[model samples]
Target chain A: MRIFDPHIHMTSRTTDDYEAMHAAGVRAVVEPSFWLGQPRTSPQSFTDYFDALLGWEPFRAAQYGIAHHCTLALNPKEANDPRCTPVLAELPRYLLKDQVVAVGEIGYDSMTPAEDAALEAQLQLAADHGLPALVHTPHRDKLQGLRRTVQMVRACALDPERVLLDHLNETTVREAKDSGAWLGFSVYPDTKMDEARMVEVLRAYGPEKVLVNSAADWGRSDPLKTAKVGEAMLRSGFGEDDVDLVLWRNPVAFYAQSGRLRLDTPAAGATFEGNSILRGTPGAPDVPAPVGS
Target chain B: MTTVPARHDTPADTGAPGLPPGLDGPARAWLADALTEAARAAQAEADPGGTWQIRFAEAGRRCGPGHADAARVELLAAARPGVADLTALYRQGTAAERRAVLLALGRLEPAAAEGLALVEDALRTNDTSLVAAALGPYAAAHLPAHAWRHGVLKCLFTGVPVAAVAGLSARARGDGELGRMLRAYAAERTAAGRPVPHDLTRVLALTEEP
Candidate 1:
């Protein structure tokens, strides 16, 4: 039951999450760059964040046997901030990084002219870099956001096949599929699509270019949703091949278009920089037994 | 039952100096190539800073992180960076990179106290790894007695094992002030109904030694 969560924020997550995700057979992940919970004051903040996504986060993931790749962008929400727009200029060099499989989480937050410009610029950057674009649709107006996003894809240089429209629900799924772009569904613990709902989508849409993700971040989300979706698919009488197509193969195929998508986990016991995710000792912690037992 | 890990008063194994021992063949080879590149950059009349910095940043990816520190130390050693270069690397580098610089300080300039600022900077943070790395032989050999004592207390405070503090026994022995500090900390924890760390007792015993 190998899994590849196409969009998860490992930077905001912890080592415990990594252990559980690895145990659940999450062999690979693609962390799209998104705004921190608070607004970043400068474009330098985005560069540092991008560096972590490239360097530190991947190292952290490798320690727990998960191969980590990231998509670099200004992100839709930050696009409106003039302070963050300079990061758009920096995206080309970041896009050239080996671990960067796409330029993404780049779409509309408010559908402002600034967002339109940033999204269009990043989509062009993706096209120039020969990478896929992970476009996040606005959470407020479901169908309208998808329509506007699909229109942008139609107008932009990036082909629809090279785009992935994310945060989709039933209302937007039909139009997103009609756009000829990849369809991405985020299953959360409570808010977004759950395992049963995801399985139903697979049944309705027939998982061809569909990618399911946890979209887990600082918010309340689950990193194990992909595995749960796989389990739900199995229970729904979908064959193992069907499960593999939706859970693993689809993400690999889309991101592999970048000529990146490294899926190899590093050797066991590898540390990141000087930090190993170890505390006390690897197999021993001197626990003071039940006091006075 | 409580286990007391082995204590080392020196740098060899404590600071992760030199190429980490037992690196598998491929890792060793990758490190060799990286070091050679760094050495060549250093030998050039005008060192290409970006080249070496890139190699330093990529060590974790190329050599694997278990040996990344060893690779970084060797890169620093091979490049023979001065205080300014080390300072820039520490300030601009990530926490991991800063740690590699701290660990390399002992080997880069064994006697000079030039790297103390980096050590002090690391000690201020609660990052256990940085705190542990900051207390490496460089700090043990150079940090003033007063600062060193606080670092030890910090180890206990952050739950970093006192064992990670290099030269613990020699420094802690016969230090009445350290004994006082340790006792006060224990009393505070007791007053708050917190379980005193097993390490507090261990260090307290060390301070009690003549």
Candidate 2:
């Protein structure tokens, strides 16, 4: 079964993950920018992170025949820092790149004023460019943050379907779906829903407007949780098509609305455009005939 | 093994002067044929098992830029027993590109000298963060040489850097003749204040002897 893990953080994973994903029939994945294991001190860290998400990550995935895509954003946990403004400034350039699919994992954490400001700024950026957003609800007081996110998206006049309110559980899923926004569940190892519990949620929710992801990062998360969810769905008597819709089609349809999810098949024997995001500088010209031929 | 005939054309000018006098035509052709087979094999086998064989063959060819080129005469200097051309390739390529090649090479030839040189060059950069990156693969390969030298001039006026020569020396790490040459070069570098150029720290650090 072809699968698309809609929200995996592959930067924390190794080449083995790519190989295993390929072997497991995972054809593609979406990596949303998130707070790294520690705080980044400068804008360069964000730039490097974006580069890895779009650059090295894709190349690594390609070795195992898996396609890699990413979302561009200034993560919520990092927004409160005074050093984050410059990084926020650099977001537009990355968003314009062909592989960036959404302006997200961006939203409120702790319902702080700084979180509100960062969320509004990115919301405006997303609106200005006509992109979708992937919102991250806070782990504590999640319902309050989820409500705030819904209100802010409405105030900004963003299409409800264009927003993906992620990290939902029993408390926030109904409100997230009631607002006409797409609902996302991150299947974590212990704290979040396990496979059996996720099956129960799917049974309750009936799979409409729902997406499941691993949200696997530098934490105690599994990179293959989405696959596990897929397995659980099949065991729960969901048809293969229904399973594909939630894990693959739903994400592709939602993120594609951002107008940046490119699916170009690289030409056979086509050489890299010297400025391959994976190799050379972003705007640098291809190696110029060895500096004068 | 079925040997294919060597492709013959005018010896291309590789910025080196005339071919070394008295070099046998048939032996050169044979080496070129073997190297060509190795290069072809490397390109075909992306798995970890065939990496060193690919590197040895590619180094023998001495192609430019990409390892998948026709063997040039310059490759001969690096084809000697202990040479590690794969490391030089990693140094010359961009970081992301190099990481892919290095990862594949590390897996296929983890214990080969090709793996060692790649790690050694990564260490020589003198950047602590990058040293661990280089050593990660080096340690994975699990082959340690007593000592290594980086900067010995191969041909007069050519001044091929230590990284280039070490690729050859790496292949001969277990041989008596090559071992003596490597130790003496290591001694000379130690006597001088400078470490061998082209990043010999990873290689030297593996040594127990002074």
DockQ of each candidate, alpha-carbon based:
0.01, 0.01
lDDT at B85 for candidate 2?
40
lDDT (C-alpha, whole model) for all candidates = 0.80, 0.62
Tens-digit lDDT string for candidate 2 (B1-210): 433324333343333231322233443444456545444444552424544444434432332233222232223222222224444545455443344344344334544545654554443332333333343333433534322221121210122223333243344344443334334444444432335444333333333233
Runs in model 2 deviating more than 4 A are: A264-293, B1-210
TM-score per model over all chains:
0.56, 0.54
lDDT by residue (tens digit), candidate 1, B1-210 = 222212222233322334666555555555667677778877887675567878898777666666677778888998877787788888778778888999888888744555876786676565788889999888878888866887888788777998898899988888887788777667645533457889989988988888
Q: What's the distance in Å from true for residue A123, model 2?
A: 0.8
Task: Give the CAPRI class of candidate 2.
Answer: incorrect
What is the per-residue lDDT of model 2 for residues A1-293, given as tens digits with 9 covering 90 to 100? 76788899988986667666766667778899988755555899999999988877776565456667898898886776666657888998888888888898899754557778889999888877788899998654456668888999888757888899998877677788889999898998865567887788788887887888889887778888888999999998999988988888888888889776754323212233332332334424221111011
- The positional error of residue B161 in candidate 2, measured at the CA in angstroms, is 58
True interface contacts reproduced by each model, as a fraction? 0.00, 0.00
